[model samples]
Target: MRWSRHPRCVSLARAELRTALAGWGLLVLEEAAVLVLSELLTNAGQHARVSPGREIETRFRPVGDGVRIEVHDASTVLPEERRPEYDECGGRGLILVDALTDCWGYGERSGPGKMVWAELRAGSG
Candidate 1:
């Protein structure tokens, strides 16, 4: 699914993911998957320095017995995981994603940007 670079797309993507997981009988992974998607999409929206109106894209699928969540944006900037200071109120999105997902990473996409993705198995958090 393609989403615009707006805050509302976060909730919209979550709703779609919820339905997709339900249909795939992967409810056990829903909570963590939702959080993962949120962080990824938010990071893309906040940090993807692309031309205006360039839309971010999302893909939800079952990989083996797990679910794969991919967020594609038109920016080549990759996300980094950093330890936030005690006094900092931001910059912990990727940290949360790493803790929640079984494995997550970013790579080149077919087009002009990169895709950030996370994979979650049924029993993982």
Candidate 2:
């Protein structure tokens, strides 16, 4: 779905997650999905290419007992889970996401943009 950077977007995301969790009954999975969404949205708003009249897109899908959260940005440059030194303050978003999720990766979307996705199990799988 499409959403602006406004505060309401966060609420919408949270609600979507809550509904998903209700069906899957996994607290950890829900939290991880929310975290991945927040990280991807923040990254898109901060790092992804943005021109006039552009908005970020996000989609959530359940694959087996795990959920996949995909964030699409207008830029082709994929996000990397780089492990920076302890002194550095930035560049830890993807790393934290990678550490939290069961699996994550980046790939090209239907258009010229890219999709960064994180998958976390709904339970102990």
Candidate 3:
């Protein structure tokens, strides 16, 4: 689904993802999936420089024994994993993603944007 580049989009995406995973009988990955989705959507809302008329696109699909989540934005800038200082309040999104997901990466979209994606293996917990 397409989401506005606003902070609320993270919760919206999480709700949709939770519903979808429940419907698919993949609740085993629900928590991790929601967290990863939140990070991806948060990055889109904060970093993507799309026009006012554009929006971030999020997709969820079943892949093998897990689910793949992707967030598409209008910016080509890829996300960087930063080593935040000890007292930092933020900048750990990707770090959490790395620890939670089976794998994660970003790639250029066909047109003018990039797609950041992560996969959560069901029953991995």
Candidate 4:
């Protein structure tokens, strides 16, 4: 599904992800999957420097006993992983994503920009 580059899109995307996970009987992965999606979507909305009106896109797929969440944006800039100091107010998105997901990464997508993806394995529990 397509989304605007607004922060509000995060909750909408999470709702869509929950629906998909429920449909696939993968609600067991809901919490982790939602966090992963939120981080990726938030990163895209905040960092992707594309032309005005360009939007972000998302995809949710059942992968084995888990779910794969993807966030796509029109900017080619990739997400950076930062080690923020304790007093920092932000910048830990990818760190949480890495800890929670079985694996995650980003790559060039078709049209423009890149697709940041994460896979959650139900077995993680």
Error of 1 at 54 (Å): 1.4
lDDT of 1 by residue, 1-125 (tens): 99988899999999999999999999988889999999999999999989977899999999878899999999998898989899999999999998888899999998999999999998653
> Which residue window of length 10 is worst by lDDT in model 4?
62-71
Estimate the TM-score for candidate 1: 0.96
lDDT of 2 by residue, 94-116 (tens): 88887788888889888768988
Instruction: Find the 10 residues in a row with the least total lDDT in model 3.
Output: 116-125
Model 3 lDDT tens row, 1-125: 99998798789889999999998889989988999999989988998887897789999999878899999999978899999999999999999999999899999886779999999987576
Better of 2 and 3 by TM-score: 3
Q: Each prediction's TM-score against the native?
A: 0.96, 0.84, 0.95, 0.97
Model 2 scores worst on lDDT over the 10 consecutive residues at 2-11
lDDT of 1 at 94: 92
Best candidate (score: lDDT): 1
Tell me the tens digit of each residue's lDDT in model 4 across 74-106: 988888899999999999999999999999999
Clashing pairs in 2: none
lDDT of 1: 0.93
**Pairs that collide, model 1:** none
Those runs of model 2 whose alpha carbons end farther than 4 Å from true positions after fitting are 6-8
